[model samples]
Target: MPATRPPTPLRTPRRRPKKSRSRRPRPPRPPPPPPSESPAVDPENCPVATDAEGGVDNAILLPDDPWTLNASSLTLKDASYKGIVEVRTASGATKRVLKYVISGGTDIGDLHQTVQDKRSGATHHVQAAKGSLSTITDGDTVMYTESISGNLLGLIPITFDPEHPPPLDIPLIYFTKVTVKQAGQFGGTLHVPGLRQYITT
Candidate 1:
């Protein structure tokens, strides 16, 4: 009877399968903040003061008076030198010679040579003018005189590049001063007494 119980059928063993690994998603990153300072400063905004001769600061005289030159398109030749020349736009405002022009035709004579020459025998002499010239070239800074009584009208500076020729279409500069003519009745006219021709290189 014991041999008969041992004769039971043999049982088969079951095994569990291995699981596959998976990657998890990562969180997104935030953007960086903008820079505080500017990349570069403009040269016009930061005008440099120089002591060298013929320097822009030394040549250009900024008038202390609140008035300015009238430089509308009607008055100015171009917008490039609009703010270069400073003048008072009041009646009978006297402007002195600030610099001299070597090549261009200006009311002011050669000032650089005159300033350097101490000998009275020298024929070259510099004389000051009451009215300012309309056209100013690359190295010229002349005084501006205001003849008409008006508010701060405008300030204009006209420069000619040595490399380029004068514009045939438009006049270089035309300065207008309101004056009363002694006709039967008082009349007004724009007197551009100091219009200079375009000086070619």
Candidate 2:
């Protein structure tokens, strides 16, 4: 072989590495929405009285009679205070009076003061025992009667204008129901009469 003087060093060709098509990155997923504050109330699982859309009636229940009560003249005996609250209708065709007795370990004077304060638009937080008896009249004659019982502290009666006449005969209904599920949460459903169904999940 003819001595080819040392062959010039061959130049290695540079090649770019292949991109990884098999390991493509995935797009990120969107975040979920926040939970609702007020849940819907299912009608089938709630009371009939709560069938109303808003779960309560907007109309105020005013007495049909006009009468006044003097807490000063009332007697607080046996840890209970007894008094009368009167109402009069605009047409003078109806009159209603509600007799109530609030009893508990607390003093009746304190209860009276509390009630008076509420009537005067004063706010005080105290728990007490309370009950009421509702009596209605048509043209100055007693027509209907009903009893009221509940947490005394939660019962706040708002007086109606003497020029406005409330319903002559209003229906009174009391209902209580409880349901327990295996789920790890508490929920409530209310079907208010003449209103929308409400559910809390």
Candidate 3:
């Protein structure tokens, strides 16, 4: 009988260790540029006035002109202030003033200034068919329109019902509206430093 030969054990192969990878350091990035600043405004040019009695036909409103805005609706940029609409009137021995802060960005809208009688303390809202819709700004945007009486015409804010109202589907019809407080009218002044010019649409 031949003796059984022992089977030789299979040898397992050994794996070599992986080499460590080295990464290069990256350079630092540069900072971004600073924001632009608005042009300096002269206080003398601020609070631009539009007088019906005065010979001045129109007062130009500019962003560079510095004017104080008590209230603002939109976000201000370039160190610019908000915008406002003010009307003053003197009838007999009485005087009155009304102010409305401009809001809702640079969309042309109607701003109605309630006219009042200084003598009787009675208020009146002028209704007219023809009026100039001036663009009002305060270094922010052309957001509103003010009705100012011209040489041969009177510009007054047109009113509408916010609840049950007509369709403002007309191309030129304004959807935004603002009603100012009561203001007496006796050959007074309307100071709109933000009033640039008449809006085409």
TM-scores, each model vs. reference:
0.22, 0.20, 0.19
Instruction: Tell how far residue 139 is off in model 3, in angstroms.
Output: 10
Those runs of model 2 whose alpha carbons end farther than 4 Å from true positions after fitting are 1-4, 22-31, 34-79, 82-201
**Candidate 1 local lDDT, 47-115, one digit each (tens):** 445433222322333334322233322232232222222222233232321121122322212111111
How do the residues 1-201 of candidate 2 rate in per-residue lDDT, one tens digit apiece? 776788799999999898857966778887888886886888776764632433322123333322122121122122211222233333333233232222211112211111123245543322222332221212211112122222223243323222322323222211111111100101122111222222222
lDDT of each: 0.29, 0.27, 0.31
**Worst 10-residue stretch by lDDT in candidate 1?**
178-187
Q: Between the candidate structures 2 and 3, which one is better when assessed by TM-score? A: 2
Q: What lDDT score is found at residue 33 in candidate 2?
A: 82
Output the worst ten-in-a-row residue range by lDDT, candidate 2: 178-187
The regions of model 3 sitting more than 4 angstroms off are: 1-79, 82-108, 127-133, 136-175, 181-201
Clashes of 3: 2
In model 2, state the lDDT of residue 140.
19
Candidate 1 backbone collisions, by pair: 69-154, 81-157
lDDT of 3 by residue, 38-103 (tens): 889998656545554332221332222111111111121222212233322222122211222233
Poorest stretch of ten by lDDT in candidate 3: 65-74
Judge candidate 1 at residue 2 and give its lDDT. Answer: 46
User: What TM-score number comes out for model 3?
Assistant: 0.19
